[model samples]
Target: MRLSLLDRSRTRSGYPEADALHHSVERAAHAEALGYHRFWGAEHHAVPGIASGSPAVLLAAVGARTSRIRLGSGGVMLPHHQPLVVAEQFLMLEALHPSRVDLGLGRTLGFTEQVRRALRQQTDDVDTFASDLEELRSYLRREAPVTARPVTQTVPSLFQLATGEGLVTAARLGLPAVIGGPVLHSPELGEAVAAYRRDFRASAETPQPQIIISLDLYLAETEEQARELALSEAWAMARSRETGEFSPLEPVEQIREQHWSPRTTSRIEKSLHRMIGGPAGIVVPAVERLLEITRAEELMVSTSTYDRDALAQMDAAVADLLT
Candidate 1:
C-alpha cells in the first residue's frame, strides 16, 4: 500500500508555536528520506494545538525543503476563500514543484462561529461548494474565462476530503476521496465505499474511484509503549471537547498527573480505540484489513504526539512497514 503523512503542525505544551511549523518541515524532509509517497499539510484556523492555518504557504516552505515526495493540503477548506484565488495559489505551487503537487479540497467551514465570522463564510450551501469546485477545476485546467497564472502543463491531482454526502460529491466530480474520523470505524463503511465506487463518474484525470484512508497510527516495540505514544493526542482531543480549546499536546506523564472526569476518560478511551497503534505485527494486519474492506489505494497517517523524537521513530518504523 502507498504510505503518506498528514502533518497538522501540532504544537506541544513546552515549545513555542513556531516550533510546530519548523517541525513539520523537518518531518517532511525526514519522510522524503524514508521513501514516503506524499507529505500533506493541514489547515486549522485559531486552533491552539495546530499551527498551520494556511496549507498553501506551509507547502511552499515544504517544497523548498524536499525534492521528491508529493506536497499538498490535507486539505484547504474551500469555503474560506475564492476558488480563483485558490487556483492561483496552487498553480504557483505546481509551477515551482511541477508534478509533485496535489490539491485536496474540503467543504468544512471554520472551527467555531467566531472563526466562521472571521473567515466570512456566511453560508454552507452544498450547491455553492459544488459550483466553486467546478470553477476551481476550470482554472486548473486552463478553461476559465480569466487565467489563474503561472500556467503549467499538468493540473495538480484533485481529491475530496470526504464523509457522508461529501463522498457523493466526489463521485459526481470524478475525484479521489480521502475519508477518516467516525466514518472509517462505522459499520456501514463498506457499503458507503462500495456506493462511492458504483456511482463514480470517470474523467480523464481519474478514470476510477480512489479512496485514501486517513487516521492516527503509531508504531513502537510493544503495544504498551505505542499506546503511551498515542495517549498525548488522545488527552488533547478529550480536553478539547470539554474546554472548547484544543490545547497543545503534553507528555504522557504530565497527562496522567491531571485529574480526569468520567466523560474525559471515556472520550480519551474512544479516541484511542479509533486509532491503530502497536508493534508492526499488530498494526500491519489491522491496516491490511482496513484496506481490504475499503479497497483504499493509500494510507495517510495523521498521528501526532508531544515527543518529537518518538514521533520521528514511529514515522521511520511506519515507512519500513509499508514501503
Candidate 2:
C-alpha cells in the first residue's frame, strides 16, 4: 500500500504552541528520510490544539527542510479564503518545490461562529465551494482570466478533501478525493466510492478517479501499548465535543487522572474504536481490509499523540510495514 502522513501540528499541553509547527517541519524531514510518499500539513483556524492555520506557510518551511518527500495541504479550507489567493499561495509553493507540492482543498467553514466571523466566512460561503475549486484549478492550469503568479509548466497535484456531497463535487470535477472521518465507517461507504468512480469525468490533470483514505492510526509492540498511545488524541476529541474547545494533547497519565463524564467516556471509546491501533499483527490486517473495501490508491495516516517519541516510533514502524 502507498503510505503518506498528515500532521496537524498538534500542540502538547506542556509545550509552547510554536513547538507544534517546528515539530511538523522536523517530522516532515523524518518522514522523507523514512521513505514516506508524502508529508502533508493541516490548516485549523482558532483551534487551541492545532497550531497550523496556514498550510502554505507551514509547507514552505517543510519544503526548505526536505528535498524529496512530497509536501501538501491536508488541506486548505476553501470557505475561509478567496480562490485566487489560495491559487497564488500554492503556486508560490510549486515554484519553490517544483513537482513536489499537492493542493488538497476542503469545503469546511470555520470551527466556531467567532472564528467564522474572524475569517470573514459565513455558512452560505460553502455554497460556492465547487465553483471556487474550479476557479482555483483554472489558475493552477494558467487558464483563468488573471493568471496566478510564479507561473510554471507543472501545477501541484490537486485532491478534494471530501465527504457526502463533497464527494459528488469531486467526481464532477474529476479530482482525487481524500476521505476520512465518520463517513469511512458508514454502511454507505462502498456505494459512495463506487459512485465517485462511476461519475468521475476525465480532466487534464487527472484522467482517472483516485482515492486516498485518511484516518487516525497508532501502532506499538502490544495492543495495550497502542491503546495507551491512541488515548491522548481520543481524550482530546472527546473533551472538545463537550467543551467546544479542542485543547492541546495531554499525557496519558494526566488524562487518566482526570474525571470523565459518561458522554466523554463513551465518545473516547467510540473514537478509539474508529481508529486503527495495535501491534503489526492487528493493524496490518485492519488496514488491508480498509484498502480492499475502498480500493484507495493511498493511506494517509493522520495520527497524533502527546508523546512525540512514541509517535516517531509509530511512523517508522508504519513505514516498515507499508513501504
Candidate 3:
C-alpha cells in the first residue's frame, strides 16, 4: 500500500513560472510528509500547461529534498529521446541516489501529431522503442564496455519492463514490470497479467517479478466531490485525447462549458469506467480489490485533474488511509 504523486505540472493561464514551481515543490514536499512511498512524473511534449518536460531533472531536485521516498517516472514516453542518452541520464541518476531510481517506459507518442511530425516521431516510430530499449538494457548490463560519462552517484539498477512484449520478459529478465491501460473488467488486462506470471523466472540478481499498475484514483471526502473532481480530470483527458489542443488549466466555468453529450460521457465513462469513487467510497477498498485481482507487487496511482483541490485531496486520502 505505497502512495505517490502523479502530476502533469499544470498551472493556471498567465501564472508566473516561479509561482507555479513554488506550488509544485510544496506539493512534492507535502506528499513526502504524508508517507507516500514514491514521487513520480510523466513526460509531455509541447503541452503549454504541463511544466514537467524534464522528469529526470525534476526527480533529481525532488530526490535532493526527500530522504525516504522513491523518485522515478511513471513513464518516460520512449519514442521521444535516444535510449542511450536516456540510459546514460538515468544511470547517472542511479549513481547519485543509489538504489532509488525507477524507470517506467512506454511506447505511446506523448506529443501532438504536429509536434510528433516535427520530432520525426510518427506512427512509424515503433522501431525507436524497440531499439532504444534494447540499447538501454545493453548499457545497464555494463558488459559492453564504453567510456562512461561521470555517473550521477546512484546505483539503482531497477530497470522497468515497460513494453507489451517485455512484461513477460520482466519475469525472465528479473526486472520489475509496470502495466497500465487496465480497463477494470477487461479480459485483455487479465491476459497480460497472466502472461507476465507465466513467463516469470527467478534469477540470482532478482528473484521476483515486481509488477506495478497505474490506475485512475479518485479520493475525496464525499462522492459528490469525487465525481466533480473526476469529471474535471476526465474532461481534461477528453480534451487531450480528442483534440491535439492543450492549454493552461481552464477556469471552472470554462471547463464546465466544455460540451459533454451522452455519447462523450459514455466514452469517458468507458475510458475511466474502472475508477470513480471517493476515498471513503472506494480508495482503499478499490485498491484492495485490485491487489486481490492483479496481485501486483505495487500500485502506482495516477490522479489526473487540473484542480488543485482534487490534487491535494489525493494526498489527503492517503493520509486518512494511514491514519
Write down the lDDT of every candidate, Cα atoms only. Answer: 0.92, 0.91, 0.67
lDDT of 3 by residue, 124-209 (tens): 54465555665666666664466345454444445453556657556666667776654444566667777777787775446776
Q: How many backbone clashes does candidate 1 have?
A: 0
Candidate 2's TM-score reads 0.98
Cα deviation in Å at residue 164, candidate 3?
4.3
lDDT of 1 by residue, 1-323 (tens): 79999999999999999999999999999999999999999999999999999999999999999999999899988888799999989989999999999999998888777888898766554558888999999998888899999889877889999877889999999999999988899999999999899999997799999999998897888888888999999998999888888999998999999999999999988888888988889898999989999999999999999999999988998998887
lDDT value for candidate 2?
0.91
- Give, for candidate 1, the lowest lDDT window spanning 10 residues: 120-129
Q: Write the per-residue lDDT of candidate 2 for residues 154-240, one digit (tens) a residue.
A: 789999998889789999999999999988888899899999999999898899999999988888888888889999999989999
Ranking by TM-score: 2, 1, 3
Give, for candidate 2, the lowest lDDT window spanning 10 residues: 121-130
Worst 10 residues of 3 by lDDT: 147-156
Backbone atom clashes (below 3 Å) for every candidate: 0, 0, 11
